[model samples]
Target: MFKFGNIYIIAAVAVIGGALFGFDISSMSAIISTQAYLCQFNQGGLDSDGKCVGPTPDVQGGVVAAMPGGSWLGALVSGFASDRFGRKTSIQIGAVIWVIGSVIVCASVNIPMLAVGRIINGFSVGICSAQVPVYITEIAPPTKRGRLVGFQQWAITWGILIMFFICYGCSYIDGTAAFRVPWGVQAVPAILLFCGLCVLPESPRWLAKKDRWEEAREVLALVHSHGNADSAWVRREMEEIREMVEFERQNADVTYFELFKPKMINRTMIGVFTQIWSQLTGMNVMMYYITYVFTMAGLASDDGTGVLLPSGIQFVINVVMTVPALLWMDRWGRRPTLLIGAFFMCLWLCVNAGLFATYGKPATGNHNAAVSMSITGAPAKAVIASTYLFVASFAPTWGPVSWAYPPELYPLRVRGKAVALATSSNWAFNFALAYFVPPAFANIQWRTYVIFAVFCAAMFIHVFFMFPETANKPLEEVEQIFDDTKPGAIKYIGTPAWKTRNTRAAVLKQERDQLASDEKIDAAAHKESVNA
Candidate 1:
């Protein structure tokens, strides 16, 4: 078998797809404020400055959020590919799309054109968001699976951070053409990812389930030279995957309607609702508009930074937070982190928004600011600090753990479909938030916070009730729980929210496992030393 030591390098390579997702996500937010990006596309006619002139609130919202909206459509692509083509191929396809989309976006002439390009990029993001975890989970040694799969989230955050820096630097250029540089930089990574895919082995589990024994054997040999170690594991895994696929195939054709079937019904619910919760936690809303908040706070021009350094800092913070999944996720699992994260996110959101709400519209500028002139704080500082807290809350827990859970919980055959549904749901909700936020800010600016807080509270309750601890649990173990009709299956039905599997016992067990593993390694090293 391949040494466990090599898993990280494999994970880092596979998870570049996540980086593409993250890069596309925050990149467009930076471009929205640039006058050149918004130039001359008028619903009715152009204004004196050659910008579209109208009080088209909804239109502005759509334009502002098109990238996220597009992602929803793109996210569905993974389900189809993962189920049919395999996770690796789906990711490779996404890389191709990312490069094309980046070029189109960099060369865009108008807002609508830019939106088209963003939609393309969003498609790739949606696919990667679903595929990366599945790929990682399949390749990672089960002992470290949760943490390794978690690396995808960390990669995303890192991408966001890097893109933010690119955006921040490019924004200083003061023209639309200058903005192109940051957008263009994305192509480099996409191209590299595409090149990398040429040599990547398809997930052996995927190969085995497809009845491609030869391919699976070849792939396994590469991963592990110790006499077809991967092949042995694949045989065990394939039995289960084959059973699930046969069950799925015999039940009914794959349909949009099938997601609601009884066996899949619960998984579907978790996937979709959790995704909605992930977005509604108000993380994206903050990322989307915090720059405007900063400008209103007085960090940038009165016209607003559109996006700012404070926002960049948020990206950096998110990136930093995102990395922890690589180290802690295998230990902490999913539910506890999400529950705690939801509360913290909501708490900070309330605090930040409440502080801003205290200033009211006058200082922040209502659409009809002339009618209601109110004094507000130099929102820049408040905006910056609040967004940092918001993003920080996002990256480590809700952001990473959310994606982590679905892939781990679902069966190998169903994983892609499940993740696809969930990811698309996430993208859809993201679109809604992005599309709605500006107008909502225009309509009942402060009330939006109230809505988000409600969602956050709902998220906390939902996770505590429905979501269980997946930390250190094998994929088989998770499915076994779901498959079990025994008392342990019913055991947790009445269990108190906080007293679930992700307990101190679980945590201590994880620690002991780590220590024992280290001792084994040391012993192996000494034995090798003696042999040498």
Candidate 2:
């Protein structure tokens, strides 16, 4: 067995990518309410209320919605970058973009400049989220894979928690500095990542695809094998990748549109559904709008540019709730954990919605009559509990698995493109929710959460039907599963669905049989020595 620390170090590399992903999410959330950051050079000066003077409701929504919309473009580009350049490079590139984007927001004297920075950061976060888990899952050993990569989800929740706290601490400062402090805080980790990523070895499997066998072998040995490994083993892996890609290439001619081919239809379905399943769970909406939820619940009040709760304390509490899941997931398996989490998420959303529906009332201080008159006292406490439960339920399941599964489900040839489409869909849907949510909050209030509860209920059904157990299978084996559906059909791939499916099962069984043989041999050798 390998030492635990080395595995952790390897895991940390991937987690840092996740960290950047989380950092942007939290940072953007922190930045959104800061009117100073939203000030416009073109719009002249501050209003009588001392907020940015420019833009009515619709125009302001556009400005607020800009970054989430830009994420669609980021996810689209990540597909090509991860599939073409390499996963590690995509993450590194994202780190650089994140730093640039963070600086733009923090330094901005007007809303337009902050908008540009937000878009840049949004792009980096989208790409970082898609690429990090794909890289980590590919590298981890089967036995510990779940535990290690689950860190990504755990990291994200903790990141959100920290950002909330930062927003809280920064809230204590008055005026422009209130917003700038939290925006600038993001630069620290991102700068660290840009420096740190340069030291990491490229993902070996990605290198193998480029025909760089030696580099691939060296990387594999560093991260995977226990100290030393046979070169033939490395060659064997390359051969496997070559066969899989060549098989996919010969069938589809390696074009991006070939993802829609008859054989790949299920693979396509899995990608789309899993992504849909992720966002539909209501996590993003909650993440996007929880501060308002908190405000309505009596958690905090507006302090100049942002809300005033102790964000750091809240983040610490959130991390404590989330980090435990990283340990339990492998013990429980992906499906059970997801089912459990979904039930709780549905429950949380219902309670949260119900509380708002029943008892929500307006506050005395805030500007908008709608918000000012919103729920106070016990109703606020319920909202706080609702936010906690929402974060807790998602921490172990939907959050990480959605990020983890896409690359595993698709083989190398189509993995990049399929992931691109899935992430793009995620960002597109996110843009819709983020765009509409604040308005929904401003106008519909409790009804907004009622809608989220409905979406979460639907996701529960989809995840139960479709998510695969991809915990252990290599890409070679995963491709063979798709190839099996057609026999000679893997060549032409127009065979009956029944026939192609049987092929997938047979190939997987063959791989399992080989693993069984090795295990049997080891057992026999141990028994023989004991008898002697």
Q: Would you list the C-alpha lDDT of every candidate in the order shown?
A: 0.69, 0.65
Clash statistics: count for each candidate? 5, 17
| Candidate 2 runs further than 4 Å off | 1-7, 31-64, 231-239, 302-314, 362-366, 369-373, 480-532
Which lDDT tens digits does candidate 2 get at residues 335-357? 56666777888888899788877
Error of 2 at 410 (Å): 0.4
Q: What digit string (tens of lDDT, one per residue) describes model 1 on residues 91-203?
A: 88888998988899888777677778888888888887778888877766555777777777787777777887787777667656557888899988878777776667788
- Shift of residue 323 alpha carbon in model 1, Å: 2.8
Specify the highest-TM-score model's number: 1
Candidate 1 residue spans exceeding 4 A from truth: 1-5, 35-57, 217-221, 224-256, 302-307, 363-383, 483-499, 503-532
> Whole-model lDDT, candidate 1?
0.69
Q: Candidate 2, residue 286: CA error in Å?
A: 1.9
- Candidate RMSDs in Å, in order, are 5.3, 5.9
TM-score of each: 0.83, 0.82
